[model samples]
Structures are given as structure tokens and as C-alpha cells.
Target: MIRIQHLSLMRGTKPLFEDADLTLNPGERIGLIGANGAGKSTLFALLRSELHADGGDVDFPSAWRVAHVAQETPALERSALDYAIDGDATLRRLQVELEEAEAHPDHAAQGHRIGELHAALADADAYTVRSRAETLLTGLGFSQQQMNRPVSSFSGGWRMRLNLAQALMCPSDLLLLDEPTNHLDLDAILWLEDWLKRYPGTLVVISHDRDFLDGVVNVIVHIDDRKLKRYSGNYSSFERQRAAQMVLTQAMIEKQTRERAHLQSFIDRFKAKATKARQAQSRMKALARMEETAPLRAAAEFSFEFREPASAPNPLLVLEAVNAGYRVEDEATGASTERTIVKHINFSLQTGQRIGLLGVNGAGKSTLIKTIATELDPLSGVARFGKGLVIGYFAQHQVEMLRHDESPLWHLAKLAPDVREQDLRNFLGSFNFPGEMATSSIAPFSGGEKARLALALIVWQRPNLLLLDEPTNHLDLETREALTDALAQFDGTLVLVSHDRHLLRATTDTFLIVADGKLMPFDGDLDDYRDWLFKTRLSPAKETQAAATANAAPSAPQVDRREQKRIEAEERQRLSTLKKPIESRIKKLEERMGKLQARKAEIDAKLAEPAIYESANKDELKTLIAEQGACGRELEEVEMAWLEQQEALEQIA
Candidate 1:
């Protein structure tokens, strides 16, 4: 259990928490939520002991091991797998000690030390550490081949995933995750949800994703009014509870206002008269003694709408046999090469259609959106835009394109130079930029602020078509809700690619799955998409390819039923034939491991007896220790072989 008592914290003179108290019970999955700059991350830093509270008592069990994702991963030449496995500090320490003990010259003196190290390794389950690390990496969307690659080779986003894997690999009693899903796709997010659900530790995550919070957390700790308010149940439950509290608070405020007015009226009427002077004086004292009920300081409300387009044309855009991808350049030859990411795409956008793109990361959802936005021309096909068509595109790069030295007012004015500065400021205010913020330089703004400014610029355009790719990235829950509401009410056609399930479900009426260089309509909703992802993961690559190809072209020639069955049978037989020897090898290894483990246990039991330590039994102790060391080594070798065989079986599938 963790207890925070009279917690008072400050960043400069800004008080984030004043006499705040919270109790976190063991095994409780908590979601820490607050407005931007509300010190959620600061609280995490305090928990990690990276920051000290101004005045507070933060107490937890001293024996507890804490784990958190590192904010920055230094570029290194270490293999991704090795880096992740290093999270198991205990296992690594034991292995290092074992190596040192074995390298000692005197076998008699080192025998006891070697035996102890092996026993510690077995207790830590060190033999399976590699498999555990690999599993974590795989769940975070790393391929087997990629797991062996140098950590420095990955991009920033991928490195973040590696850091997440490393954190999850640690055997921790308390796990702190700050925006763990930011770099993850929907599939990986779903996978993580399951993993965290099964974790036997206390988890506290800070995230802006409502759906993720709803899926993973059982309690919500809201930072509001310089206090930590704990709410029972998930995010939706927290919203309901908070809403009810706000209503009650407002009612109390109104009631107190009426009472104050009544007291003032009585006091003013009689204070000048001698007859009621005593009563008036007493009433004045009562009013002064009354505890004030402060008015509710509501969060800044963010709301905006898309301006109606000048024209709404049927079939706003059309793509025929389009091959959408990037043009790569060979550095040595200085020659550009076209690489199609999404091929044979036949898609159209009509007025008022809301479509969401679904796929794993690197499945070309961005490519399709880019192709439609005209950020990239189709490699080889026709992409026609209707007359009077206007597109409002929002991507991460678009946010980066904002002039850092300019204010929100200036950015809006650039789009509408004829509009008055006040009117433009009003528009920016709707997106939460008011007063000095509208005129101040955005150089020091956070990512969420920049993203909001970019979106504000888009809403001002009133485009007939909206193409948003991961627009919710770096956005808080409030802004995301605002975007969802605005998109829901927008009359223009929309194609959105976001991992935010709540926004997708609320705004998109249809979903298109992008996989295997093909895009096709999914008949079901997000839940079905999740099931499809799991099934696809379990399926063989060739089968997945075949399914994608069949879905892409409805008119493709189909194999006869008998021929298809025959081919499948033959494929199954071949897979089984290849797996037989590996499976046999794995069974033999398991048996060997079991026997060695049993023998080691017997040796341990004998070693625990007092007689084994007697001078007369010194030689017996040495013999037993040597046997124990040999057993541990054989067991480790057998486990590795078993893991290899399992991988081979997976490859055959």
C-alpha cells in the first residue's frame, strides 16, 4: 500500500498540490488524469523519487520494486533483445556473479559460490529471460528480425517502443506508464491492455486516451483544484461522478448566493434604524462567520465547428487502380525508385461520408491518406478531384509546419488576412487560446498546444473534404472530445486514421482495413476489427496474403473447391512433416529439464541439512555442489534448445 499524506508540491510559485492526500492500495490499476500543465507528470516524478515534494509524506513498502518507461532512450549499438533483457536486474546480476565465480582458479573455494549463483538463477527463472524479453518486444510490434537489430537503427518512435518493452520486462511490484500507447497502433494497444490486465502488480498510468483508460484502469485519480481526487471505477464512471459533483457544487453556490443576498437585504434595511439595530448587528456577525463556498472554476471549454463548404459535390475525389507509396532514392546511385505501399486501390469519397482506416502500423494507412491529400501523387493511376473540392489535411508534420515565432492570431490572420484581428482572436479563443495567449509567440508551447493551433487553422478553411491522419496524437482528452464532436457534426466528407477507438466509433460510420498492399471495407465495427487482428496474428503469412488478395479483387479467378481442399491438405501435411523432428526434440528437452530439476531439488534438500556442513561431510558437500552446478547448466541448455524448437515450429506455420 502507498499513502500520500498532506502532500504539498510546487513548481516555482505555482502550487500543484496543497495538502492533498491519496491512498493507493496494492494491485489497483490507476489512471492519473489532469488538464495540460496540471502536474500529472510532476506527480509521477515524485513517485519515482526524481522530484521531492515541498511538504508531504509519501510512504510505500520499502521492499517494493518500481518500474517505469524511460522518457529518453540513448542511441546505442546494443541489440534490442539484449537491451530489453537487461531490465531483469536480478537475473543479470546473478549471471554476472556466476561468470565471475566460474572464472576463479580454486574450484574448492568457488564450488559453494557457484552453487549459490545457480540456485539464485533458478529462483529468478533466468533461463527463460530471453523468451520473456522477446515476447514483450513482439507484443510491442517488433518483428523477430528487428529484435536482433541494433537499438540505434530504430527511429525515435520505435525506440520508445523498445523502452516500453524494457519496462514491461522488469519484474516489478509497481509499474508506472506515462503515455505508453502514444507510439502503439490499435493492435499493440489491445495487446498491451491484455498484458496489463494479467499483470499481478500495481499499475498507475498517465494517458490522454479515454478508451485506453477505460480498458486498463479500475480507478481514476484526478488532479483538480490543487488536490488529488480519487474516483471509483473506470474513466466513464469517473466522468459521471465528476459531472454529478459539479452539479451539486453549482447548486450549493447558488443557494449560498441567495442566502448572502437575503442577509444583506435585511442588514441594509434595518441597520440605519434604532428599533432593529441590535438584530441587524447580530445578522452582520452571522454573515461574517458563515464559511464561504467558492464558485466552481470550470475547465476551459474547447468547442469549434467546421465552416460550411462553398459547395458539396458528389464523389469529391476518385482513385482508380492507384498505386500509392513513396519514392525512395538510392544514395550511391542518386537514382529515385518508386515503392508502392498500397497497390491496386479503388476508393472514392462522397459528400458526408465518414470513414476510418484500420491496420497495424506500417500498413500504409498514412500512404492512402497522403495520396488523397495530394501530399504524394499516385505512382501509376488516376486521382481526380471534383470541381470546387477543398481539402483540409491534418498530420503531425502539419503541426510542425506552424511558425514557432508567430502567435495563434497571426497564424489565423495569415489564412484570413481580410478578417479583423479581434474576430480572428475570437476564433482562436474557441480553440482555447485567449487574450495574451493569442498574441504571444508559440515557441514555448507544448505539443498539444501546437496540435490545437494546427487544427484551428484547419477548421477555419471550411474544406469540403477532411483528411486527418492521427490528429489525436499529443492531444488531451478534452481537445480530442472537442475534435470528435466537431467531426461528428461536420457536413464534409472525412477520412480519419487514428488509434483512438472512442473517436473512431463516435465519428466514423464505416471502416476500411489496410493490409497486404490492399484496402477494403470492413463489414463490422472496432470490436470486430480487434478480433480480426488477433486471428490474423495467429494465422500463417501465406494464408493472410491470400485472404487479402481475395478481399481486394472480387472478380479474381477462384480455385475449385476440391483443388482448394487438396492444396490445403498438402500444405498441412508438409508443415506437419517439417515440425515432427523439432517437436520430438522439444519433448526430449522437456523431459531432460524435468529430470534435472528434480535431481537439483533433491540436492538442495540435502544441502539444507545441518549434517552436510559438518567437517566430516566436507567432501560430500563439495561433491553435491558440483553435481548441482552441472544440473543447472544442463537444464539451461535444454531450455534454450526447447525455445529454439518452438521458434522453428512458429516459422513453419
Candidate 2:
């Protein structure tokens, strides 16, 4: 539906595209991938006709509708549903005409106008538009009630989603999205991916989400050094193809370099020979005609050596009866209260298992991860670190802590202490910070750059236990895959909170979910979780959207002394009602932990018997050891719950 012919685009002095040609056909899902500022978004703009190319033609089919969703949204006062439903202005206008025609048949132009209005309304499917609009809105996470709420009340992230809904609902033959998944939580992102996959039209999306790209897109278009390269499959396939291509390209360059060197050496020796003068001259011309092959940029590989610190074999982390949350008070009445975000989450980890933590945003996933990593005492429970375990944390906010005065090179020098200069550059280059980019101070680095640098730092540390929260944010598909591969190879225990479905599935075998103020297990793939969400949360008979958003409820308003007392009394009564269930869950988790611990101890004793390893009946020992290890990990998880439970019990007391 859209094509770029001999297109060239420039931003200031830099040429982003040079005689680059590309095409997007109906129903094609194309993922635009490249380094930052490599003109991925610029190319989208040119295709959408929002930006003019410096040269060449952008051929688009006649009457083709195009829609673009930008990174930032504008001010909108309409409700999210209204904003989405208004995707088709022509349809809306047609509806208005029909309404006018129905109400004012006696007007001067009634007969002719009514005929035209009838045609427009029929063409627009005006009768079924409301139901269609509701489906689009609700699928995009807006509740039925939210259809009338002011969009201005929603945060920028939600506004972006509303904008996306608008784009999707439009009469577009092709859709262009720039970093569309940046602000979405995992659930909303999965919803969009599914929508796009089943969408009848074409889509070209720019996203840092690797899983989304792999799941929805069938083609990959990479823009690099003013050229467009196409791959035939998803991101993972594209990666393998790219690697193979790079190898072939490097070999071609190497062969050409060798031939040129040999020719030059011969020319150098035979320049004055009368018999070889003609040959030397011809070789010189050939050398002049040979196009200079581009050198392969080095990949970033952390070359720093690390020594795993000596640590005990006990659980690397422990949480006992923890209560997590914040303090809240009714301002009007000055009635203070402690709000529990989640209570009675207990877990412990040894040196081997990789655990994935999953939850919807605001479900207290980060709070639990942070409380463990930073060694903060649980609001009511105890958290203890195992003996000698060296912890490395990569929080979402960790990138902001980099010192401004230091360049990527200097940061590596200080952090790794002994990394060679060339090795440091190569490492930074792999993360796409090649050459001078590595020397630039961290102060001016973009969000993606900071994230890459933080990842490099964490990888370089090689700690025995790594705690990573959203480490895949701002990463390209290739880098995220690389990280997953590296993590799979890592011997250390990993506890990570991530929204990247690909990363979670690749690196972790166990899942812990935080929801409803409790810890639960999710024994399925990311797609399975998504399916469950739509079934449970977005079922046809689900509550209206507006009701749900409103139910999150605003804090109590200001009140006089008597009102304050009344509010306090109500809060106390509500807490009393909730206290029983919270207490019950804590007790159950603790009881489970005790039983697992007993099983673990009995297996451990059997494994330690002198003849266990040498016995001809040795298979029994292997099974016992495996069972003991499994029981040990389960016990740790239970302890984490026990801690959370104890905290909840104290709060109720």
C-alpha cells in the first residue's frame, strides 16, 4: 500500500536515508529496528507524509488512509472512549447528518439532504458503529462507564493508549506507530499485539519490546547507515539471518582487503620494471575502481574478569512475615492510617534457581523486589540475607545514579577497575555506543543509552545473585535476546521483575505473581496469562470500565473533627472486616513452609549417608538429592510468605 522509491532524507548535516527503497503491503506486520536516532521514526514520518523527504518519491496508493501514533500525546478533554470512538470523523459527521435529516424533514433542503444522508449513514454503517466503538474502547482497556469520563483526567500513558485506539479505529490502510509500547504495562501491550496480529490492514510499528515484535511481526526492516535491509521473518529469525549476513559481509571484506594488499605489495615492488609496468598500471586502476567496503564495527562484549565471591550454601535471600505498603491519612479529619499494599509474601532463594516475578503495575511487584534487593526491613516482617552472598541490583531507577562527569569509558574503568581501554570500547560498542559515543559524558545520554550502560555495568559485576527490575526496557530486540542468552548461561541465581515476555520465558523457569495483596504462582506462558486476563477481566459480562477506574477510589476529603472521627471509625471497621482473610492466608503459607522444610531436612540426611554416592543402588540418592533441592526452594518461597503473613498478623493485631 505504501512504497519509498529512491528516497533520501537528511536531518541537518546527517543523511538518514540515501536512495533507500522500502515497501509495506496490505496485512504485513513490519518491525522497524535500528540503533537510536538511526531514522526509524523519521522514515515512518516520511511514509505517513508528515515529513518531506529531501529527495526522491514516496509512492502511495491513491485513496489510501494512513494513521500515525506519535510518542507524545496532545491535550485531550474527551473521555478515553469518546476519544477512541471518534477515530472516524467522516462516520461521526454522517451520523450527525442522519440525526438532522430525521429531526428536520420540513427544512428547505430536506428531500435531497435526506437522500444523501441516508447513503452516507448506510456507507458508514452508522447503525452498528456504537457497538464497534465500544468493542475497540473496551479492548484497549477503557470501561463502558469511562466512555463519558473526561480524557484529561487520565495520565499521559493512558492518553497514549487512547491515541492508539484512535489510530487503530481509523480508516487506515497502513498504521505507523513510534515506540508505541513505551508506556504500556504488560497487559495492555499484549492486548495491542493481539489486536494488531488479527487486524486486517497493514502495520509498521517501532517498539523496544522484543516479545511484541516477535509475536506480531512477520517481517523486519532494519535501517542502518542510510540503507534499508529487509528480513523475511520475526525478530528472532531476523537476528540469526543478520548474524549470518554479518559474517558473510565480514568475510567478503577480508578477502577484498587481502587481494588489495597483495596487489599493492606487487605494485610497490614492480613499479620501475619495464616488463611489469603495464601490469602495475592496470592494477592501480583496478584498485582505484574497487569500492571501499565498510569496516565491521566491533561488538560490545564485557571482557572484564570476575571472581564469584565465597558465599554460604544457605538461601541467598530470606523474608519473614513481611508487610509492604505506605502511610495514608484523611487530610480533612487528620485521621492517620497505614495502607497495606501487600502483606504476607515470603520467599528465599539459594544459589541456583532463576525466579521470575510477575504482576500488573501497582500490584506491588517493584516494592517486593526493591525491599529484597535494598535490604529494607519489611513494614512488619523480617528480611535476612544469606551468608557471603554478594548482591547486585539493577533497578529501573539505577541508570539515574551514574555520575555525570564520567564517560562510558571512565565508568567502566572505575567500575571494573582493570578493563583494558580497547576492551572497554569494544564492550560499549556491542551495546551500540561505538567510538566517540563512548567518550561522551553520561549527563547527556538518552534513556536508552543509560539503560544499555546500566546493563553493561551489571553484567560486568557478575554477582552471585542478580536482582533486575525491568532490565529490558529501552533495549532493542537483539540486545534483549543477547541478555536472555547470557542470563541463561549465567551460574548465578536471578530474581527479576520484568514486563518483557520474551525475557521472562527465556531466563526463568518459575513464576511468582503478586496480586490481591498476596503471592501466587502463575504456571503458564505470557500468552497464557494474557488469555486468562481477557477471560477473567474483560469477559463480556464484566463490570463497566468507568466503575472499575472509579472504584480505585480517591482519598477521603477534608472534614471537621466530628467527620474525622466518623471516618476513622469506618476505616477501623473496614480493616476489621479484611483482617480475617489476610490472617488466614499468612497462616496457610507458614504451615506449608513448615511441611516442606521437614521434607527437605529428611532428604538432606539421606543424601549425606556415607555409602549414598558409592552404593550400586545410587539412583535413589540422585532422586533424593533432586527432591531435596526442589523442596528447599519451595521452603524458601514459603518462608518469604511466612514473613509476609507475620507482618499482616501484626498489622491486624
Candidate 3:
């Protein structure tokens, strides 16, 4: 187990944690979550012994080995597999020793040393380490051929994947992963989730992907208000528990405010009167002894909506035998060749439709989205757009296009130059850029901030069609939730390509599978997609049409239009009927829980008073204690009932 006690830490002048305490048990998968600047990474650094705590102690078993993904991967000529294999320091040491022993001049001593080295290497499974490294690379979306390529040959994002694979290749008792899903596609993310679930060591991951956290973590460690809070269960459970706590805190704050006001009023009215002077003095004393309840401070606040488009057009875009890809030119021959990605795509994106693009990395999801966004022209066939169609496209590279020297306000103003400056500021404020942040240069802003700015600029355009490719790459949980809410309520057509399963499920009603240079409608949800990925062994080399269809759920037979509409309507009605009562029950239980918690708090506060323990108030103290216990039991029952209702609602949904 790892124990962190009275752990005070500071980043320069800023205090990140003060007297924080936490205990992490062995083999526990923990999701470390916080706002963008809440020192999550710094805590990881402290755990890795790269940074020391200013006060208190962090202790763990001395023999435990820790592994973490390196932040940088230098450009090297070493094969990718070789670099990943080097992650096992013990194995590398043994290999080096074996080489030295073979070169030794003393024959007898060298033979003994070589024999010992061989036994150690066999014990360490050195012979199979290459295969293990290859598996890690494959799971991370690398091809078999790519495994032999030099580490310097991959791009920055692919290099990060290499770094992740190297970390996973390491043998350790504790593994630390910081945003491991940032560079992964849906398939790779799913694979990583499975891999982490099977890991035998303690795992601490800092990720904003809620589904990923829920799938892999058994506990959540939240950093808030300069303290570490441990919660049992997954991310969803942590959310429910935190929300209930907030509600109880707010109730206590309100009760304290009322008590304070009542005492103040009494003192003001009778402090000078001879008849009630003693009572007024006593009230003042009670007021002075009362503990203050601070107002709730949210970790982050961000909410924005896509403005209603000026016009809505049916069949907003059409692709007719479209081969969506790019053209490659030969410098020496002065000849160009068209490289097709998604071929023969015949589809129409209608108004108010939400579609998610599903595919492995490099399988051309981005190419299809780019084609629809008109960023890339269809190489072979005609691509048509409606007369009044307006496109608002967001991609990772668009974030790079943002001017570093410019402010959020400047970006918005440039898009809508005629709008009022205050209106623009208000718009930027919705994306969490308030006051000076709106006007300050974005040069020093983090990637999340830059992504938010890019999104704000897009929402301001009021486009009839929204095309997003991995828009949540740098966003934290709060911003992602805000974006999810906005996208769910959006009235425009949406075609999203994202690895975030939560966002994909929340905002998309349909899915399109991009594979083997073709696009097709997928009739199932994310779960089915996961099964298909596993069954097909998703990789660039194995991505064939036959393999994709082999494991896919059978397509439903076509029916009459009227019959199909009726079936869909009936299903909707049935779901609504099933959901309504569970939702109502949940609401009622929440109300009851709040009242019970507030009453319990009031009783506890009264019992804490010194006068309550005196002989005169002994009976009243006993009554208060009895009532507190009853309230506690009732609260637990109501909370359990609420949990059941929530589970039912989720199932119905």
C-alpha cells in the first residue's frame, strides 16, 4: 500500500495541496481527476520521486518498481520494437552483462558468469519480451511493419503512442498513465482499457474520458480545494456521491444563514431592553459560537449553446460515387496519383441529423469528415452542398491555426466584426473566458484553452452543419460535458469523429462505419462496435471488408416506410413510459434525502453545544441523538433507493 500523510506541496508560490492525506492500496486502479490546473500531474511527479513534498511524507514499499510514460521521445535511429523493449531496465542490464561476459579473457570465470546471466534472462522472460513489445505496439494502433521502423520515422502523435507502448512494456508494481487516450482512436482506446483492466499492478491514470475511466478504474481520487478525496467505485459513482455531498453542503449553508439571521435579529431587537437583556446576550453568545458554512465553489464553470442557424436545408449535402482522399505527387516524375481513402460513398446528410463516424486510426474517418467539410475535395466523384448550407468545421489542426498573439475576443470579433464588443465578450465568457482572460493573448494558454477558443469561434458562426473530428482531444471533463450538452441540443446537422464514447453516445443517434475504403451504416451501438473490433483484430494490415462484416451484427431486413416509422415510434413511446416513473422516484428520493440530511445536521449542531450536555438539557440532548440516528438510517435507505432508480433509468435509456 501507498500512504500519503500531511502531504503539503507547492508549485512555486501557489499551494497545490496542504496537509492532504490519502492511502492507495495495491492492485487498485485509480482515476485521478481535477480541473486543468489542480496539480494532478504534479502529484504524479511527487509519486515518481521527481519532485519532493515540501512537508509531510509519502511512503511505500522500498522494493516496489514504478513506471510512467516519458513526456518526450528523442529522435533516434533505434527500431520501435527495440526502444519499447528497452523499457525493461532489468532485461537490458542482463543483456549487457551477458555480452561483456562473452568477451571476458578468463575462460572459466566468463563461463560461470554467462551461465548465471542465461538463468537470470530466462527468469526475466527476456526471449519473449520482443513479442510482448510488439503486442503493445499493435494494440496502440501500430502496424507490424511499423514496429521495425526507426523511432524517428513516426509523427509527434505517433511518437506519443510509442512512448505509451514503451511504458506499458515496462515491468512494474505501479504504473502511472497521464491522458493515455489522448492520441488513441476508439479501437486503440478500447484495447487499452482491456489491457489496463487485466494489469496486476496498481494503476493511476489521469484522464478526462469518462467512459474510459468508468471502464478501467475501480476508485476515483479527486483533487479539490487543496485536498485529496478518495471515493469508492467508478467515475459515475464518484459523480453521484459528490453531487449528493454538494447538495448537503448547500443545505447546511442555507440553514446556517437562517440561524445567523434569526440570532442577529433577536439581538438587535432586545439587546438594550431590560426585560430581555439576558436572553439577548445569550443569543449573541450562541451566534458567536456558531460555525460558519462556506459557499460552494465549483471546480469549473463552462456552458455554451450552438446558435440557431439562419436557415435549415433538407439533404444538406450529398456524395455521389465520391472517392474521398488526397492526391500525391512524384517530385522527380512530375506526375500525380490519386490516393483513395473512402470509396464510392453515396450518402445524404439531412438537417438535424446526428451521425458518428467509427473506424480505427488511419482507416480514413478523418478523410471522410474532411471531405464533407469541404476542406478536401472529392478526388473522383461529385460532392454537392445545399444552396443555403453553412459549414462549421473543427479538427485538431484547426487549433494550430489559431493566432497565438490574438485573444479570444479578437478571434470572435474577427468572425463577427459588426457585433457589439460586449456581446462578443459575453459569448467568450460562456466558454469560460471571463474578463482579462477574454482579452489576454493566448500565447501562454494551454491546449484545452485553445481548443475552447476554437469551439467558441465555431459556435458563433451559427452554421447549419457542424463537422467535428476529435474535438474533445484537449478538453477537460467539465468542458466536455458542456460541449456534450450543447451538441445534444443543437438544431443543426452533426457529423462527429471522436474517440470519446460518452460524447459519441450522448450526441449521436446514428453511426457510420468507415473501413476498407468504403462507408456503410452501422445498425448497432458502441458496445457492438467494441465486439466487432475485438473479433476483427482491428489493424491497418487486417482491415479488410470481409473481416469487418464477419463479426458485425446482421443488418435488419428492409420493411415498408410506414411500418418502420410505426415501429420506431412505438419503441420511443415504450422507453418514455418505462423511464418516467423511475425519474420521478429518483427526484422524490433526492428531495427526501436532502431534508433528512439537513435535519440531521441541525440536530448534530445542537448536540455539539456545551449547554446541551448540562443536566438541565439532558433529556433534549438524548432526543436529539436518537433523532440523528433515525435520520441517518432513513438517509441511507433513500440513497439506496435513489441509486436503484438511477440504474433503472440508465437501463431504459
- Best TM-score among the predictions, by candidate number: 3
Give per-residue CA lDDT, model 2, range 320-438, as digits (tens). 78887766779899986776777987777877888988776667877777778764447788888877777778886677688877898888888867768998888778767789989
Q: Whose TM-score is higher: candidate 1's or candidate 3's?
A: 3
Instruction: List runs of model 2 lying over 4 Å from the truth.
Output: 95-119, 125-134, 137-149, 292-313, 320-323, 341-343, 370-443, 453-465, 478-482, 489-492, 538-653
38-142 per-residue lDDT for model 1 (tens digits): 989998898899999899888889899999999899899999999999888888889999998898888789998898999999999888888777777766788
Q: Model 2: how far is 491 from its true place, Å?
A: 4.8
The lDDT for every candidate, in the order shown, is: 0.85, 0.74, 0.87
lDDT for position 259 in model 1: 74
Better of 1 and 2 by TM-score: 1
Worst 10 residues of 2 by lDDT: 298-307
lDDT score at residue 491, model 1, on the 0-100 scale: 87
How does each model score on TM-score?
0.81, 0.71, 0.85
lDDT of 2: 0.74
Evaluate residue 420 in candidate 1 and report its C-alpha lDDT on the 0 to 100 scale: 88
Candidate 2 accuracy as TM-score:
0.71
TM-score, prediction 3:
0.85
Order the numbered candidates by TM-score, best leading: 3, 1, 2
Off by over 4 Å in 3: 269-286, 538-653
C-alpha positional error of residue 215 in candidate 3 after TM-score superposition, expressed in Å:
0.8
